[model samples]
Target: MKQAADPAKERYALMEKIQMVDFALVELTLYLDTHPQDTQAIQQFNQLAVESRDLKSAYEQRFGPLRQYGASFSGYPWNWGDSPWPWQL
Candidate 1:
């Protein structure tokens, strides 16, 4: 039998993935700045970029925008100002 999906868990998972990818991108960017000719770092950065975008989209659709001004209307009466900041989780 299939189990019910947990929205909170799913949101946390996606947020974790997004943070990981963002961290990797930042690290790779720093490395690329010094090693401009490193093709591997460039490729990794590009891959992470796509991953971050997809993860953010999924999270926003399920949960809500990471930023206060991030596309509204998906949820309803615009609760972007509500509690439960990302760090609070």
Candidate 2:
């Protein structure tokens, strides 16, 4: 893939979808934990949780880490220095 591929749009879309899935998972988890007899709901919740994990991993791999983790990256003096905020897309 070319470095010129504009990932901004794709990145934003994925972020939105992931958030929705996360919210659903949280709501369903709380409900199902208290109501374990709902096998169908539990199954759907499990499937969605897996999808969410995969989406998060793919996003992080394509972009940078969602959160800075230790010194896993090399420091640079590129900008800010006066740079732009991430959402300036």
Which runs in model 1 stand beyond 4 Å of their true positions?
69-75
Q: Rate the local accuracy (lDDT) of all candidates.
A: 0.79, 0.68
**Per-prediction TM-score to the true structure, in the order listed:** 0.83, 0.66
Task: Report the lDDT tens digits of candidate 1 across residue range 1-89.
Answer: 99999978887787888899999999999999999999988999999999988887777777776655544434676667655666665
Estimate the TM-score for candidate 1: 0.83
Candidate 1, residue 14: lDDT = 79
Tell me model 2's lDDT, rounded to 2 decimals: 0.68
User: Clash number for every model?
Assistant: 0, 0
CA deviation > 4 Å runs, candidate 2: 1-5, 67-89
Candidate number achieving the greatest lDDT relative to the actual structure: 1
